[model samples]
Target: MNTRQLLCALTVCSTLASTAALAGNAPLQQVQKKWAECQYSTPDGDEKEQCFQHAITRIGSYLDKEPGNPELTVWLAINKASLAGAQGGLGALSLAEEAKSLLEGVIETSPQTLDGSAYTSLGSLYYKVPGWPISFGDDDKAEEMLKKALEINPAGIDPNYFYGDFLAEEGRDKEAKVYLTRAMQASPRPDRPLADKGRKRDIEATLGKLK
Candidate 1:
């Protein structure tokens, strides 16, 4: 995949994995389910954009009620990133910037929240977005954030999968396969069947590419 396609794929994958962190919160769980449907089940087009927009609105209402909640804030960021991937263009960069800001806030206040999901999401954004004049994509920063996420959640599916994908993107196939394998073996989240299933597919697809 080229840069733009890789960016969108990684963006969408990171969004799916991050939702697992919110499984314990009932309202957030609803949002997570809706996101899975919109991302994996819905066809890519105007319809998918509307689905994400509705999800963004729902997440916004929850954020308004629990302004101090890191989990809710992370979900808001995740949905916004997903929307940005769906609506690719000049406007997409603005949405991605907003998402980055939200995730950074969570990292500042609650880096350990949701098993360091903010770090994983932020890492994915850093590596996937363009660098310099276009956006803030930085390999060094991405590696740092992703490694920090792994330090916090060594056995988590999202961190492993994201780190693996990052490595693969950088042409480090052997190291990437190791992390992808670990991601596949991650303990299932009982409350997040859809997210788990979807993540498994992502892991498998990435693994296939390494072959």
Candidate 2:
């Protein structure tokens, strides 16, 4: 994988939305907006990391106040995962671990919460992180959780993209192309223009690689 593909692979901690059609709390919305800018529009790695850290801090405060607020907790996990993606290596392992914990908490709040996004993201983390004594990456678990995510969100863009990317890396090119094409066909989130655009780039790149 080259630079963009590398970025896409790391950023599997991509956008996560609320379970309901209703608007999320203000803090969650702010974090999502900043996350998008860092993930896509912002070009500087340091700047993007800074943005993600800021979101981590900001969302952390909300989580502190609310304690068990499921919405805030999920976004906190997402931001932390974003930080992990930005930082990479051993330092990223710590951040991803925290993300996993927070995501689990969110799932406990409700299994189907965030349209099973906790499962989707946690699944992505398992596959993306380094394996063994180094970290807890597990391909079997990744597939299981990702398939669960698809059951919850069959038409969701992120789950399809990550699953397809995983299959491509595993050299399951035909099956990977099927999911990537489905991802391209998935509905766009009007609230997340930059995320949608960036993911499309990833989907397209992965498709080109398979061909």
RMSD to the true structure for each prediction, in A, is 13.0, 12.1
- Per-residue accuracy of model 1 over 17-48 as CA lDDT, tens digit each: 76664554778788878988888888999999
How does each model score on lDDT?
A: 0.90, 0.84
Candidate 2 has which clashing residue pairs, if any? Answer: none
> For residue 184, what is the lDDT in candidate 1?
96
What is the alpha-carbon lDDT of model 2 when measured against the actual structure?
0.84
The CA lDDT at 189 in model 2 is: 88
Provide the global lDDT of candidate 1 against the true structure: 0.90
